[model samples]
Target: MNFLDHPFNARAGDIIEVSLDKQANVRLLDEHNFSRFQRGASYRGHAEHARQSPVRLRVPGT
Candidate 1:
């Protein structure tokens, strides 16, 4: 997914949460980091099940 297409336009000093496979990954993208991400830089990190509530899984088609 393109960063520009992200619902929240996270600016410098802003943090955004990315959900993957029912796991939540939080990212803090500074100006440089944000630029790199926008330019397709690969981000390597670990995600954990931090949410207390269950996340509803949705398929593309029912």
Candidate 2:
């Protein structure tokens, strides 16, 4: 799934986990992963969960 500059399909209560350490990433439904985990200011994730999970994601402003 492309959670960057685009939205993906996920049902309600679908889990969206964001992890950043060695890399920035988004795991949908706790199984599917975003195709790209762009570093710097090129990443994004949902600000909140929803049936329409277009959650906001981004690299911390520097």
Candidate 3:
């Protein structure tokens, strides 16, 4: 499923899981604090479960 087209319904502080094919690299970002913006962790080849923050997910280089 393409999450960009059909995103899951979630609210703040909810825990969400993301799964990726072994070759995918995803960069997760916390956009909640733009003034003190800090990048979240990067993951590849596995699934990750984390609390939902104001975030954006992308491949490393557009």
Candidate 4:
């Protein structure tokens, strides 16, 4: 399945998760109808704090 096909539904303090099998490919979108995760921003997951950033990745092998 293509990850890009699914729209991002992030927010100011939302902890979003993406699946991966050893490795994964990623892209940084400007601004779509959904929200985004900005680097340096803080988020609370269950009871822990975390940050967010736009990561560009290349999965080894096709």
lDDT of 1 by residue, 1-62 (tens): 52223434433434344454443533444456556766788753323344633433221121
Quote each prediction's TM-score: 0.32, 0.24, 0.29, 0.31
What is the TM-score (0 to 1) of candidate 4?
A: 0.31
Q: Candidate 2, residues 1-62: lDDT per residue as tens digits?
A: 33544455555555444434333344332122233343323334343433332444433221
lDDT of 3 by residue, 1-62 (tens): 12222235555555544554443323333333221323333423212343443334432332
CA lDDT, candidate 3, residue 43: 25
RMSD of 2: 12.1
Clashing pairs in 1: none
Candidate 1: what lDDT?
Answer: 0.42
Worst 10 residues of 3 by lDDT: 32-41
TM-score: which is higher, 3 or 4?
4
Give the per-residue Cα lDDT of candidate 3 at 13: 51
Pitting candidate 1 against candidate 4, the one with the higher TM-score is 1
Worst 10 residues of 2 by lDDT: 27-36
Which candidate tops TM-score? 1
Q: Give the TM-score of candidate 3.
A: 0.29
lDDT per residue, candidate 4, 1-62, as tens digits? Answer: 33444555454544445454444444433243113333434432222122333332222221
